[model samples]
Target: MTDLVQQAGIKLDATASSPEEAVDICGKLLVELGAITSSYADAMWEREQIFPSAIGMGFAIPHGTDESRAHVIFDQLVFVRLAKPISWADDEVTCVLGIASQGDGHVELLGNLAEMIQDEDKLAILQNSDNPEEIAQLLLGND
Candidate 1:
């Protein structure tokens, strides 16, 4: 998972004015790494059109829908911390966590991430951390 984080790349204090741009930044990295096809990014955007990905508490997990799984080459996560918050539905999002996974594997990853981010202190630490390795460690841990 740490390898996935490293390979997918982490953007701290990224300059994206909107949630779309933020998700795109992370999605493009996954495309560059061949973890997912370009269409997967489109799927994410489409999914957002149907409903916002922002799960609240300043974080948004941008991901493709079930139909878009065909574009995924592997399971991966891309973290992006925006320089400014963007409106995502009813909430404001300053962090975007892009998830790409083949088949049903993402369910578990999403569950774990949800649990991890539920801790306000942990989320605050993640938002403040400047080091990618440290952020990855906080997310992936010793697993």
Candidate 2:
């Protein structure tokens, strides 16, 4: 597990209802959590019309790789939770991790994130925690 994923990463909430709603919710969540610009939350909805960033894994990792954000330091892994159930094309994911990354390193970061999710202990811990900080610690404990 990476350090960022443990501290200011995996543990969060958005109270949204769908992947589309999650985009804005996640953006505001980052601002609330003090990790992203206020405008970042609204960025996803605009870009989704071009190419949907919904990646399935009982999770939807949305992002903005659009032209405007091209040169910004967009390396961030944010968390979002639907206030109600949301369906991805592949599966219904209650949890979403919205990544705003602009570097090739995201490939490796994604692999690690997958590994973190796959770990049985980590999975159970995160699944059981209501508090985001505990969830984050559970995710990072493996590291």
Candidate 3:
């Protein structure tokens, strides 16, 4: 979606035993994209401790804390599909949308994500699709 998500950022069949591990993996992707520094991942974990990111519909959006926005180089998103569902706070999450955004960019991203979650057909496709392009298209509202 939006140029923020590249095929490289769409990770499929990734494995993480815990929420922290999943968040760390997401942070690594953001760092690889040059969207954020390493500390931003830690910030995500800290934020998770205070408030879980799980938004139901089998997805969780993880992002840096407000203060950690300093580590952000730009606005970007990394989508991670886990090999197995992991318990995240009160929900079991199979997908993670990691965000590294400056200013209020993340708010818009979250809003878009909320809308996406309400689309059961798209959500179903995202849950089962292994093709990065397909997933990207769905996320971008092109499919």
lDDT of 1: 0.80
**Residue clash pairs of candidate 3:** none
Clashing pairs in 2: 16-83, 27-41
What overall lDDT goes with each candidate model?
A: 0.80, 0.59, 0.87
Give the distance in Å from residue 121's predicted Cα in candidate 1 to where it truly belongs. 2.9
Each candidate's TM vs. the true structure? 0.90, 0.69, 0.93
Off by over 4 Å in 1: none
Higher-lDDT candidate of 1 and 3: 3
TM-score leaderboard ranking: 3, 1, 2
- How well does model 2 score by local distance difference test? 0.59
- Native-vs-model 3 lDDT? 0.87
- Report how far off residue 86 is in candidate 1 (Å): 0.9
Writing each residue's lDDT as its tens digit, candidate 3 over 1-143 gives: 37877888999999999999999999999999888998987899999999999989889999989999999998888899999999999899999999888887667657767888788887877788989998877776677
**Residue 38's C-alpha lDDT in candidate 3?**
88
Q: After superposing candidate 2, which stretches have Cα over 4 Å from the reference?
A: 1-14, 33-35, 70-74, 137-142
- Model 2 residue 141 lDDT? 45
